[model samples]
Target chain A: MTTNILLITLVVLAIIALNTQKLRRAVVYLGVFSLISSFLYLLYGAPDVAIAEAVIGTTITTVLYLVALKKYQVFTIYFCSDPNDPNRRNLTNNSPFINNLESFLIKQEMEPQIIYSEKPLKTILTQDKFDLAICQTNQKTLIYGSVDDYQLDALEDYLLTNHGDLNIHLIRYTEGDDNEA
Target chain B: MTDNSEIITRMTGLLYPFILLFGFYIIINGHASPGGGFQGGAVLAAVFITRYLVDPNRCIQLKTLKTAEKILFVCIILYPTFFLFSTSASHTELMNLIYLIAMNFLIGLKVCSGFTIIFFRFVFYEGGIL
Candidate 1:
């Protein structure tokens, strides 16, 4: 009965770890899973394997995953603009808003990678994987940010408070939403 | 300056000697026990990791450790081939026990150094200062 329970718990933990949205939480789940598996190993009379599992699986891998997650600080930004407008070419790249945003991201300890794309905003939104997308149309700058992104709330606050004169509109959208913003 | 909590540092500090003693015990009694070199080495490596949690900026001699690991690996390979396979050496109970203990010790040291190096490299170079 105990073995069956452990096996069931192990399967449940593995599924939960796989489905967890947050990387940190997934790492924690994996740690728990390893701990339980090691216990199961001990129950099966392989104390050596159990000890190895307990040591390597529970501790080492969890720390490694956490460090990797911490080191991954790069934030990707996609800039999209109208292709036909001749003025769009010069206006998009030299914007003071982007410079400020980059500086703000750096201040937040994120390495921002800004990519200038001639593709339409909708195409970039649906096709490319981006943390934040900027669309320049006429006088207003439309910033589409992921709702799941923890930094979006702070970025919105910063933009509204500091750059009120820039006519920047922040739009929060969930992933895979096809609605035009 | 290490930003580690006083409680954590103190607790792990208290636990350090016990962890070291346990790792050594595993390596020494490897022939009679379920846990041998690799598992004990991993436990020893955990000591270094806990040391990291206590003081992130503590300097560990990685170059010396790498050299030691390589030398230990060579010794691990040579020791078995010389004693176990060579017909000239007589197999006694004491010698067999010594052989097992010595091999486990060498392997434990090698594994401990290797894991520590991997972890330190990830922390210092890949994961930045923190």
Candidate 2:
């Protein structure tokens, strides 16, 4: 019965680790999984392997993963929408396009920080510090990005190729305080 | 990374001697026990890791550690070939036990240094650079 419970818990933890959206949580889940596996090794009477697993898995690997995570830079994106639109509530829920973009950023090994703001595009551009500022007006999406950002070109290419039907117009600006068409 | 936390630093400091004691115990009794060089070495590596948590910028030279590890590797290889292969010595139980204990101790030190180097490299020189 004990073996059965541990096996089931191991399977559940594996699924949870795979399904977790946050990378940090996934790392933590994997640590727990290794710890339980070490216990199982002990139950199977392989004390040497169990000791090695317990030392390497439960402590060292977790620390390494966390340290690597600490080195990953965060990419901030500000998402703005017109406050008075009749379909404003729909914008609060993530659209398929937003999800796709987030996944794309994750694939590039970046942690995306998306902030939804109801402020005007001009105000957001002048007031906030952001890597990408997206404004949704009616049926069209306007993306404002700084020219100095190296990743902007790849992001623009990605959006143009994959989401051309969304009518995204990429606008480049010199700095945050000033906007030029 | 180096934040001064009273509880973590103090508790780890308190447990330092015990951890070292356990690692040495594992290495010494490895001939008759389940754990040997690698496991005890990993436990010893934990001592360095906890030391890092207490103070990250202690400035232990990795070059010296790398050199030490290479030397230990050479000794680990040569020790067995010289003693175990010799035909003149009688294969007594005590001599065999001594041989196992010496091999385990050398291997434990080698593994400890090796793991310490890998951990330090990951901590200090990982990412951003080639």
Candidate 3:
């Protein structure tokens, strides 16, 4: 009886928290929602949904938001605000490779930065946020790099797809914001 | 150094069932409402983590684990987000629910895969004698 009431109460509170202007708070609320929703699922005899809520609803979403926050400063404003705002700038516009970074990396050509890394591994490494660590393990040439989870993920395709020479092991701990392992 | 069973063995014996229960709860409740695969998988993964912690020497090989995660993560992002915009209906309620479910599933996949990877990275990567 009380469990149901408490659950409903929590859902209401989480909804309120999510509506706030601050991005971090919203992420927090979403986390709360995930936790509570899991409990609710348990109450309603839906163990499956409860587990998903706890894991997916709570953890991953928060990590994604936090990652985005750490990288982009959380955007601070809701995405829908101010269409005519001139100050907003797109950071991804300046890229030397195909289309944008994803396509450039996807097409199996070394990035311009990769070419630049020919100087000194450390010197070229300073040019961008990502750093490569090349090695020959078991005669299978490997080029590991330092990148965020997203970029690491982008690099993942190159790995599993059997890219002939590149066995990448992204060391995610190298750069800023390293909460995740 | 400390008596091994005093801390870990007891904990594993005690904690295993609850963790399993938690995972089951997440899975069964998923489709009709909030939770789903990723969340459930994560809970299941947590059990492995718990097991690994208690006994570091044991090998936990979750085969085809990464692939499943990738598929789920991709589905979560592309499917749900796309559906959010694509499905235009008069009820608006149904659309909202669909979007929410899609998003949840994506999250579930990502969580499951991520936990699995983390297991490899931290717990099991070095192989024996932690």
Candidate 4:
């Protein structure tokens, strides 16, 4: 009877974990599942297996999952390009820089969401908050990022080292300036 | 990641020694008790994990861990084989117990290092610290 209860609880936890939209909540549910499963293992008279299960399942796996989730956080990048620019027409679907940037973000384990905007740079900057904003003019590319973002420093360094040939300028917006503008 | 609460740091410092003692006890008395190599190693790994939680940016010496794991793994394989081949007749109970204890210790070391390596890799590389 006790085993049956534990098994049913495990099933319920698994289902709830699967159904949860939030990844963190799902991790928590999985932790609960592991805990119950460990208890079940103990009930089955395999104390050694139960100990292993309890340790690996409840602690190590949960921490690993949490770290992975943190690593693969969504990185929102907004691209605002001037429609009238002649370079815009040439850069329509095949922008090598954008592709490279996306690949770089992926390499860093970030899920990059690139939003192409027909609106002006100032309007996009002042309106919606973003991790990064790229403004493409005829001659140069302006990369606007918040000074508070720790990743921006790495991104800037990467741009300077890897894409030195490209006319890319990195602009950092301070916390005070962000609210005023 | 470097910055953590004072309470966490204090609690970890207070509990770490006891945890290590318990893990060692589990590993040493594994044959006579419910716990064994994997369980004890997992418990040992929890100590590192707790330290990581207190300070996520803690630098782990992977080279040392890898070397230790390799040595333990080699011992786990070679020791049993040596004992099996060297013994002409059936082994005594004392010999068997010694063999089991030694194997358990090696396994515990291997598992502990392996898990610690995994944790460090995940934190350093996948955690986007670089």
* Interface RMSD score of each model: 3.8, 3.3, 10.9, 3.2
DockQ-best of 2 and 4: 4
Once fitted onto the true fold, the runs of candidate 3 whose alpha carbons sit more than 4 angstroms away are A1-181, B1-14, B23-44, B91-95, B126-130
Candidate 4 RMSD computed on C-alpha atoms after optimal superposition onto the true structure: 10.5
Tens-digit per-residue lDDT, A1-181, candidate 1: 9999999999999999999777789999999999999999999999999999999998899888876776666788888877887887676666677888889998887778888898878888888878899887777879998776778889999988887886989898789332111
- Worst 10-residue lDDT window for candidate 3 chain A reads A73-82
lDDT, model 1 = 0.85
lDDT of 3 by residue, A46-141 (tens): 875665567666755565555445333210100111223353233123422113333544353322232222233344334434434443233343
Q: In model 2, what lDDT does residue A24 have? A: 82
TM-score leader:
1
On DockQ, the candidate that comes out on top is 1
Clashes of each: 0, 0, 19, 0
Candidate 3 residue B112 C-alpha distance from true site, Å = 2.9
- Positional deviation of B44 in candidate 2, in angstroms? 0.6
| DockQ of predictions, in order shown | 0.49, 0.29, 0.16, 0.34
Model 2 interface Cα RMSD in Å: 3.3
Candidate 1 per-residue C-alpha lDDT over B3-105 given as tens digits, one digit per residue, 9 for 90 to 100: 5789998999999999999999998888897899999999999999878878888799999999999999999889988896786756888888888899999
Residues B52-107, candidate 3: write the lDDT tens digits. 54665666555577777777766766775566467555537766666655565557
Candidate 3 lDDT (Cα, whole model)? 0.54
Candidate 1 segments whose C-alpha is farther than 4 A from its true place: A79-110, A116-123, A135-138, A174-181, B1-6, B54-60, B85-89, B122-130
TM-score of the A chain in model 1:
0.77
Give candidate 3's fnat, 2 decimals: 0.41
> Of 1 and 2, which scores higher on lDDT?
1
